[model samples]
Structures are given as structure tokens and as C-alpha cells.
Target: MAIVKLSATERRRASAFFTCLILALCAWIAITLSNSYDYQVKEVLVFKNSPQKRAFHPLQSDTVTATVKGNGWQMLFSKMNEQNRIIKVDLSKLDSEAYVVVSTQLNAINAEKAVDNEIIAIAPDTLYFDFTNRSDRKVPVQLVKSVNYQQQFTQSGNIVIKPAYVRIIGPSNVIDKIKFWRTDQLTLKNINEDVNTEVNLQAPDEGNVSIYPKTVQVSIPVDEFTEKTIELPVKLVGNVDFYNVKVFPQKVKVTFTTSLNRYADIDEEFFEAQADLNLWRAYGYSSLPVKVTRLPDYCKIVNIEPHNIDFIVKK
Candidate 1:
């Protein structure tokens, strides 16, 4: 048996080829290691139970802890772009005593290499939350504006409300600040007759509160008035001793104003004028006691022309 030996040149060429292959392999491993080691901690999403129901607010504290794994260069880039470290958690399905598992991944890495093994897991597996029912309450009425009638016309009666208060329900924090609902408009314009209408209650412009009874019925009375003059006839009451006594302008006239709806019911018979006879007895006047009769029930006297007249007596 005989073994064939390679020439010196052939052996050297083979060795050089083997050495180049080893160097290339080493370079490839180094590059892979460098790329895989570049990564950063982006953000840690915490699922905390909010004090309110069905409401979400941004967490103010930026102190988030997360375990991130990625290429070294990618991690450095995440540090530069704070958004790359954000962790998002859905709150729509939150419930009392219920926890959810949140899986996060790296984003916004400029590296050409795809992130093969990049993931972050929250400790304790899931976030637990507790939900509660909101409290409800009723608040008193608050008058925000005022109404004034035209001249010669006035508000004759009190303003009436069917339900003076409103019901409010919501989270405790929001319910506490609500005082009362208001009405934007309550008018008393050109109303010759009684008014009965419904008014909507306005909610607070800025708040989380909600009102149950959003509307109320209001009743207002408007009256039309006009001045008038009428004569009131004097009448004698009780017998008077015989004497020569003259009563001047034996009739008195009164003037007043009232609503047009009630104007037709007004007349001279509604005025009453009376002078006490007993008072005149002190003055030695036998026929001084004069009384006016036939006064209307629904009328008031604004002024009396010739309010009183002197009586002359001769015996």
C-alpha cells in the first residue's frame, strides 16, 4: 500500500483557505452578538383602579419599570425616543377583583434586522382592579337670573315650581361639587293671562355630574292694569237724631287700576266710604256720621277725589 502526498504549494494554499473560513465565521458571530445585544427599556404600563367608573385618566408618574430585551443599538434608540418605551393596557373590560395579563413589544427600532426575540412580561401575571357603583343625590334649586315686568305691570303672585329640586347621581367626588341645576330662561312678557309651562334644567358646564330630573314645570301669573275713576254713593246706617246738618258732596268717587280680565267686574258699587257717627258725636254734630255702601269685592281703591268734606250744622 502507498499514500499520495500533496505538494508544498498545494498544502499552503489549503491552509490559507481554512484560515480565511475561520476568520469569516468569527466575524459573523461577533456581528450577530452585537446586533442582538442592542435594546432598551421603553415603558411599563400599570393598570391601576380608577376612583371613577367608566372613566380613564393619564397616569402622571413617569416611573415605569419594564424588562425589555432587544439588540443593543435598538435599545439605545428607544432611550432617545421616549414613545418607543410606552406600554398600553385596555381598560374597557376592567372589573372588580379581576386582573389582566399585558404583553408588550418593542417599537420604532431603526435597525434593519428584524426583532426575533423581543418581549416583556408583567410580574404577577395580571393587574387587578376593583369597580364600584356611583352614589346619587338631590340638590336644591338655584336661581341664576331674574325677570322684571314692564312699567304699570307687576308680578301679582308668587312663582310656583312643581318639583323644586333635582336628582343627581355619579361618582362621590363629582357628586359632592354639584350644587343645583339652573334654568336659562324664565320670562314674563306680555302675559295678560296666567302662564303654565315646562322649563328644562341646565347642568353645570364643567363637571362629571349627571342629573336625573332634568326638567320642571313652572307657573306664573301676569296681570294687565288700567286706572279708572268711579263714584261711590253714601248710605245712612243706623238712625240719626233730627238736626240741621249739611253734608257736602254727599257722594265720593274712587279710582283704581286692575287686570283687564278682571276689569269687566269692576264698577262704582265696589267703592266704600264711611265716616263714623260716634266720632262726630264728640264734635256736637248730630248728622255727621256718613257711611258709603255698595262696594265691589274684587276691587281696590287707588285714590279718592274729595276724600273728605266738611259738614255744616244749624239747629
Candidate 2:
């Protein structure tokens, strides 16, 4: 193929067409860069540089409307870059409750995307905060756990927690309301043996509040149990001297379940079966209900054999 050379008149026309296109693009950009525009960024983050010794709690809104004035291009760029709208204030200068007047400083805000544009104004130019003395408190820790035991298994003794108390420090307003710190929810299913584990504690929602020793050791003792039955002599209760009371079948089978660890420690003497003497006098009933008034804490009563026993009273 051969190239087609254009005439002088044709070349001039082509050049003028290209020149006009370039001129139009440049004019558009120039206009966009020179025209001023207003932009409002909602929820502009107001970071606080608080003093290490004093904790400053912002009782009011921490966000502000950053209304900035700049060229159309800069405004549009800032709108797209949400991070550039954030500004930080120093709270170390505060002595007590005060209103801090904050002015937008281009150089200090968003140093990475520093722009030459000017800040028209910032809404709620003043920020208010309450500064209180900071101190630490020791609060007891509570475990939030659910244990579903397998058949014939029961928990024995108390649940032990290492470092039962934690240190919490924050503003007095918040710390005073805190009675105890709680551990994260822990659930064990079909557990048949002792459980020893470390669990994390829930963190305080307040930004200024902090807790030391975020985790604690939890130990739960579990043991297998079996039902045991023993015959016990019944004793009369209530005004026994008024009437001579005697109960037929003086012995009652006490059916109970006990953890294996404490099975040997339990004895028939530890149990006290009793029959109410008042019932014999009130309704003059021939039989009275037998109850095991006292038993070991580790033992769970399954049934009181021969629930009712015959009784005879003689005046």
C-alpha cells in the first residue's frame, strides 16, 4: 500500500481541528480548577490527643461537619477521599470542663493528602468534654459458663477461678457503675471430667476504660455419681414431751446420688430422718411423712423410701 499525502489546505484544516479539541479540553480543566465549591463531610472524625495521666470523656458528639471551600477539582477529590476529612485535637491542655474552639488547619489535617485549599468553616466549632480524675479499682470477676453433664455425672465442689479479681481504671462516672467484670460465654457439652481452661473477659465499651488481666483460669471439678440406699432410724420433731410418740418401721431407706469422690465420706449417720409429732396431735393421723432434714451437700436426694411411716401416740 502507498501513503496518501495531503495538500497544504487539507493539512491546515486537520491542524485547526486538532488545535480546537486541545483548546476545549484545557479550558474545561481551567474553569473547573478556578471555580470555588462548598463541601460538607458528615461524621468527620475528631481524634483526641488526650493526656496520659488524665482521662477525658467526650460527653457530647465526637463527630463534626467539616465545611470546606476549595476549587471544584479539590472539593471533588476530597469528597472521594473520606480519610482526608479527619482532624485531631489536643486534649492535654484542658484543666477541667471547657469548650474548645477548633479551627481547621490544612497543614495539620491529613498531612499525607495535604492540599492548598482553604477551610471555609467547621460546624460546631466548639467541642465540649468532661475531664475527671482517673483511678483504678479492683473488681471481682464472674464466670459465664454452661455445663451440660452426661448421665451419672455431676459437678463437685465450687468452681475455682484464678485471679478472681481484675483491675479496672477509668473515669469515676463509668467505673462506679461497674460492679463486676464477666468472662466470655463458655459452654461445655456432655462433659464427664474436670474442665480446666483459660477464658477471656469482656472488654468495657467505654473507650477510656481499660481492664488489667484480660483472661483468667477457670477450673470446674466433675465426677461420676451412683445412687446409694441406706436405712435410717426416724426421730420425732415438735413437742414430743406433750405426747409419747412412736413410729412403726423405725428405719427408712434413704435413696440418694453422690459423687464418687465423696461416696466414701458419706455414712448413714450423716443422715437424720424425722417425722413431725405435730401431725399426730393435730389430725391424729396414724402415719406421718418421713423427711431427711439434713444431708451432705454433695448428695442429691433421689427418693425417700417408704415416704410415709406409721406412728402411734399414747397420752
TM-scores, each model vs. reference:
0.33, 0.54
Provide the lDDT at 92 for model 1.
45
Q: How many clashes show up per model?
A: 13, 0
TM-score of 1: 0.33
Tens digit per residue, CA lDDT, model 2, 72-145: 78866775776665566656555554656666343455443355665656677777766677877999999998
Model 2 regions more than 4 Å off: 1-57, 61-127, 131-136, 170-179, 205-209, 231-251, 268-298, 308-315
- What lDDT score goes with residue 210 in model 2? 79
For residue 208, give model 2's deviation from the true position in Å.
Answer: 5.3
List model 1 lDDT by residue over 1-315, tens digit each.
898788999999999999999999998866775675523343546333333454222323323555556765555555565644445555444433344445422232213113343555434335554333566778876544355656666444566776888887665666677776677577555444566887778865423345657778887666766777777655433327655656677776677776666677777655667654444655655444344444443344577656565666565
